[model samples]
Target: MPRAVLRARGALRRALPALLVYAGVRALGIAVLAVWGYWTGKSPHQLLSARWDSLWYARIAEDGYGYTLHLPGGKVHSDLAFFPLLPWLERGLSAVFPLSAGDAGLVVSAVSSLLAAWAVYLIGERLYGRRAGVALVALWAALPVGIVQSMAYSESLFTALAAWSLYAVLTGRWVWAGSFAALAGLTRPVGAAVVLAVWLGVLVALRQGKEHGERGEEAARPALPRMLLGAVLAPLGWLAYFAWVGVRTGGPTGYLDVQGGWGNGFDGGLAFGSFVAQRLFGPAFAAGLGLLVGVGLVLWLYAACVRQRQPLPLLGYAGAVLLLALTAKGYFGSKPRLMMPAFPLLLPLAVAAARARPVRAVLTVSTVVLVSAVYGAFWLNGSGPP
Candidate 1:
């Protein structure tokens, strides 16, 4: 076989353990959901593949967009607020198989989740080691919102693209990084995080080249064109979609206006802070405290990532994702799902786990898996969107 094929086989062999762990953890979650749905007289399939954004994506796939819903209180929701990539994939998948668009979406999400886990592992391994990579995958798989990974939603697809883009940057494959970043941009608004990673990686490279001597600069000159090309490509998909939305709506700020109609905007966290504050004074005080703790933990993780001196790409991506998740004004319940793409925040914990005794690491991950499975089951059975 060729060298590339040999290298790929070797990489898969190394990633197998992490993949297996992720699969097991997710399987446990699905099992819990299945039992809970059965006992609660709900269909697990419906829960995973036909609710909330999944319903919107399936409708978009089947109907080809141009949907508008007038909510009470003068809120105008448009299907265009949902990104196109997931719907496109669902449409294609359904056409190729004997499945409805909704079912096809679940398939798409399942495959994408595994791919995302693989990319997450590769990035951690590239930065630290195999153990750290495995730890990172387990930590990510056991996240409180990990159930969303298996849902027929865009999170898995977006995360796969984003993680691969970050991996491409880490491996110095600028063109690949840009390509994945663009695909990510097409998946969700948070895809901007991956674009930021690619841009930051390029800028950092260019700066390092500047700092080098004349000989080193000459050595770096050949890669400069590709780096520049990658940076240019990073935002094209996002810009293209936004431009298309603008044209379709017949206004320059059409996309922004559409999102605004859904009560989504960047308010620098003021809206989110107020939302939390409101809960704290009511019977929901405990829930408010829990929310505060969650936010604090995420912020602390980012701080730990920074203290560990992560690469600029990881730092920039994490920072951008953090900013967008906390600052965006929308359904507060969606914050955890929005923050799911910021996998780099788990690095500090992953590194610690990798350094710990094997038994301790396994036990901790096992406990987290149990918690996530039970919480996911309970959360899904409730009348709320994940």
Candidate 2:
């Protein structure tokens, strides 16, 4: 066999456990969603493939952009607000196969989510150890919004690219890291996090090279040409899309204007703080408390990750994600899903699970998985993530 095939097989063998755990948790989430959807007279398939953002993606896939939705409240929502990569893939897939754009989106989501799980495992294994890798993937898979991974949304695609880009950065694969980061940038606005992380990784390499020391297999600075190329490629996807939007809207800051139409922007978390405070001091005390706790826990976990001295790329990406999630003016319910790509925040929890007694860890994971599954079902069946 070719050496590449052999290495691929070996990698698969090593990742099998993590893959299984990820698959199992995701399957449980989907099953719960399926049962709940049926009981509520809703189709799970429709919920996954045709609701909310999925419909917009499908519309963009079936008909090229030029769509502007005028809300009765005088708000104009443009299709240009969405990045193109997911709809591009959906269109290509639906054209090549006997699939609707929505089905193509679901297929893309399902496959990309598995790729994301694999990349998450590889990252944990690279930074910590094999057991921690398995734990990390499982923890990510059992998040309360885990059902989003199975939805026909760009989160799965963007996450797969971002995680793999981070993994490539850690391994010193400059070109691959930049290429994946570029694709991630094309997937969502949050792709900026991936680009920033890769740039930070490059900076780290440059600093290490100057110090005549290396970490991991990086014994010296990356080749100048490759490093430069990686840096150049990292931001092109986002810049290109933004430039295109600017040209289309005939304004240099067209993208920002589009986001403004949706009432989204960065305000350094002041808006989110007021939002939490209103709930905290209002009739919705319980819900507000839950939001406060959730945000606090996320922040605390990120602090733990930093204290643990995770790789610079991981820290950079997680910090960027957190900043965007907390500061962006949007639905608070989507913050968790927005931060979903910052898997490194779960490193502390994964390490804790790895250090526990086997049975105790299993029980803890099982309990969390059950709760997450039920919550996912209830979430999808209710107001639904915005």
Candidate 3:
């Protein structure tokens, strides 16, 4: 072979393990969903395209946000139930392409998932090294809830926005970070976490500079003000949508009533925790036990964070993600999937793995693949959560 061709081959060979790991995990997850759909006498396309959560998004896309579903209990207001960003994008993209609102949502989600993986690579490489970047990306793609990444869901899109926004914050691109945070806030209610983390980082940097009595350009930085502005911009889109819904419904409480219709009213975690405890000690106790184990796993991750002295930005991001996951109502079975965006929590372990032998790395990745494959398959079959 030519020298250039040989060098390119070598580079690809070096990257092949990580790529294969990612592909294998995601492929298994997709295969599981496909096989289950077939066995259940359901079309894979419909399974993939069916309006699950996508239905509400499509409604928002086609109808431009309105309240409906007046029941004996009350009016179930959807406008306040979902954020406007994803549906708006779906509408815009469908306008240009001859795709249904659902198809458009899936296309957007797939693209966002790929971009999120790339962003993970960039952030991991910057924080640790190339191997850590590769491992982290693979780990993220192989998550047991991997099916969500391929569905017409907002998880992938939100992760992409959050990851890139954090990257921008770390690189001192304050305006870009703020812009992305605003978009993320519009996409999901959790966008506040990224905005808060960035602002806190800026505040810490400023305080350190002042304490040192430095007279340099770095010391007189105007980062805090920009960070605060970024934080403020994050929630505007969600608030605007709620306000519109309130005006149209002729009551500010209309949105909350809609969420209550789906048993997702924000009454706090007490009721939710009781429901989970019942599940844990009841007939489906094994699954509840597994969830408790997952909580323990999160605590272990927190301990690792302290041991490794990981940055406050990462810590805050992970904490916010955990809080959101735990505080949510309904679909208690999907908590693991909901927490998938917090993949940065594994960066410390990924960095450590980068220093191990190639053989050990392969073994570690194989174990993850084997377990995730089984778990992912069960999840797709609707045997896991509601």
Number of backbone collisions per candidate: 0, 0, 1
lDDT of 1 by residue, 1-386 (tens): 89979987988888999999999999999999999988889999999999999999999999998999998999999999999999999999888899999999999999999999999999999999999999999999989889999999999999999999999898888999999999988999888888999999998887887888787689789999989889989998898889999999999999999999999999999999999998899889999898999999999999999999999999999999999999999898889989999999999999999999999988988999999999999888877798
What are the runs in model 1 whose C-alpha is more than 4 Å off?
none
Cα error of candidate 2 at position 349, Å:
0.6
lDDT of 2 by residue, 1-386 (tens): 99979976887788999999998999999998888987899899988999988999999999989988888876788999899999999999998999999999999999999899999999988778999999999999999898999999999999999999999899888888999999998999999999999899989988877677545336553476687788889999999999999999999999998988877778888889999999999999998999989988998999999899998889999999999999998667788889888899999999999999999999999999999999988888776554
Residue-level lDDT for 21 in candidate 1: 94
lDDT of 3: 0.73
Top lDDT hit:
1
Highest TM-score: which candidate? 1
Q: Give the per-residue Cα lDDT of candidate 2 at 385.
A: 53
Report model 3's TM-score to 2 decimal places.
Answer: 0.85
Error of 1 at 50 (Å): 0.4
Between which residue pairs do clashes occur in model 2?
Answer: none
Report every candidate's CA lDDT. Answer: 0.92, 0.90, 0.73
Off by over 4 Å in 2: 213-222
Per-residue lDDT of model 3, residues 1-386, tens digit only = 79969954764455555555666677777776677677787555655555467777878888876645555665444555777778888999999999988889889887888767767776787788789988888878877777778777788899998888887777766767778777887887677677676776666566667877766336446665675676666556556656766786688876565567666644556666787698798998987787678778877887787677766777787788878777768656667777888877888778877888989986987788667766665665563331
